[model samples]
Target chain A: MVEIEIDEDACVGCGSCVDDCPNDVYQMNEEKWKTEVVKVEDCMACLSCHEICPAQAMEHRDIHVAKRLYIDRKVNDVLDKII
Target chain B: MDMEIEEIRGTFRPELIPKETGGDIEDYEEALHVLMKFVGSMSSALEQVSGRGANAIVYQAGKRMGHDAAKMMEKTDNLEQAMKEMGEVLGVEFYFEMWKPSDQEGYTIEKGNETVVKLLFMDCVVRQTLRRTGLPQKGPLCYLLYGYMVGAVEEVMSIKGKLDIDHVGPNACLKTLTIKWGGK
Candidate 1:
């Protein structure tokens, strides 16, 4: 089951990835189409969306890495000021 | 500087700290170093690319895009070579030149005599895939890439307190070169 993850902050709502994916795996969410896990078996693991993400946002991971990276930005912002 | 950084780190993004690069500003600095190395390597490789007389312009955008990511990611693979090989496989040739305000071909100012580095990169040809994709077309790419580099220096790098970008290309023949800042 391929899970969909969206970092709304990074999702510029550009919708480029939606056009690139062939498996119909993503869709527009709240107008942005920010990385929806629409299909499980269809994922080709092409990394097209990953490479194309201009904001360094979005990724297909084993759910764990996805969750961790999702929070990394916020953490980095706080830590960046101190250590 | 250390004390100043500590004060700044006090307001950092806590969540990003532990996961990506061990939660420290020190690590972040190290990451930026790595990222710059990657970018430099990419820039160097671009010098060899030819662009096949295809009428193209290439430049780096989102000034911090390459820098911030470069600082964090640890690349074990030869991406420089990989990018080169990717060009070969795709039958596209590219060229790039990295600059600083102090280098040769470096323009000189009249009165103040202050030298400032204006970083830039340009492509010699537009790729077939890009042409078909309906992304921002080449003309806009030229405009934005130039503006983006100025943003990088003035905003991201914080080298200059304030700077403005100026463009001077879309030449009579095949290409365009945008000049950033007030020319000499």
Candidate 2:
């Protein structure tokens, strides 16, 4: 099962994830005015919400993290030395 | 900086096969990146020149490839079996699986003469190529996979099929495949 964690302190209640998720995995908490994971079972780990979220307040755990081969390793090595 | 190219000298004969490929992992990585950039440039240029027709052209090309790839596979009327076979045909690079909501009883839903199934593509080469060139999703390149899946299903089941993109993201994408029963 996929577990979702939302950082309420960072959440601006923008509801972008709620709007972006195709599976309705998230819903806005009217009382807290923040986002909450309602249906985590339907979450497909697409991570589109992370892109749309301005605050980056959510994290999905124990899901298939797709391979990202686009990142250049040589560029990362230079950045790693500088940082 | 200048780099030296290592040349391999080997005698080749029509009957004899080479025991090893000369390239290393770095060579493959560089080749893959170059191919991605080339494909991305072609896709973008095609879109710029042909507009929406570029998608159809790419889709047709992908569909033809899919048909050729699936030609040797066993034919079946079962959608699930065909999808499993398609996973093998697409191999690891285009890894995908059938998806459904928690509340849904099954992965597939039937309506009238059509059966719909949600496919969650976990790893797609098209998505990777788009990211490599900073191209947005749902562009002309994405249609290639759409046509590929539809073509494979149609060939396997002898039925008309279509794939619609429901959502796309950096990590994954969701698409709905609809298969219509009866003769093509």
Candidate 3:
């Protein structure tokens, strides 16, 4: 089963993930305005919500990490040194 | 900057068998990456040159490839069977599976003469190449898979089908495939 974690401190309460998720995996907590995962099983690990969330507060565990061959290794090496 | 190119010299003859391929796995990997960049550049240039029509051009090409690839598969009216067989034709690079929302009872929905199913593409080389080239989603290259699916489905089921992009994410993309069970 996919596990989802939301950082309330990092969450800006923008509701973008709530609106963008096709599976309704998230819902806004009316009390705190922070996002909460309502249906974890329904989450397909598409990661669209992560892109839409401005605060980058969501994390998914035990999900299939798709291949990202786009990242250039040399560029990453340069970035690693700078960061 | 300086570069070096190593040349391999080997005697070749038209024969029943060859001794070796004369290259290692790293050679293949380097070649593959170069090809990826070449293809990505062409896709972007095609889009810039033809505007929206580029999608149709690439789609037709993919549809033709799909038809050719699925030619050896057994034909069937069963949507699931056709999908299963077509999955092999798409292979692991374009990995995908049928998907549905939690509230949905079944993967396929039947209404009158049409059948609808959602497919979640998990590992798509086209998506990776697009991202590598810094192109946006749902561009002309995306239609390649759209036409490929419809072509395979049409060939297998002998029915008219259409695929519509529902959403695109970095990890996966959702598409709705609809098949009309009547004449071609």
* lDDT of candidate 2 over A21-68, digit per residue (tens): 988999999999999998898999999999999998998899999888
- lDDT (10s digit) by residue, model 3, range B1-184: 4658899987777672555767886676666678778888898899889998999998998788778778889999988788788888787778888888878998899989999999889999889988887788899889999888878887888888989999899999999999998859
Q: Judged by lDDT relative to the true structure, which candidate is superior, 1 or 3?
A: 3
Worst 10 residues of 1 chain B by lDDT: B167-176
**Best prediction by TM-score:** 2
lDDT of 1 by residue, A1-83 (tens): 44546688888877777776645666767655465656645553444566566886675664212111112454577799999
Error of 2 at B39 (Å): 0.4
* lDDT (Cα, tens digit) per residue for candidate 2, span B12-101: 675554545567888878888999999999999999999999999999987987787788889999888899899898878789999988
DockQ of every candidate: 0.01, 0.86, 0.70
Q: Positional deviation of A9 in candidate 2, in angstroms?
A: 2.0
What tens-digit string does per-residue lDDT give for candidate 1 at B16-42?
Answer: 776555347756755644554554344
Off by over 4 Å in 3: A78-83, B13-19
Q: Could you tell me the lDDT of residue B156 within candidate 1?
A: 27
lDDT per prediction? 0.39, 0.91, 0.87
Candidate 3 residue lDDT tens string, A9-82 = 99999999999998889999999999999999889888999988999998999988889876677678779999
Candidate 2's C-alpha runs over 4 A off are B1-18
The TM-scores of all predictions, comma-separated, are 0.24, 0.93, 0.90
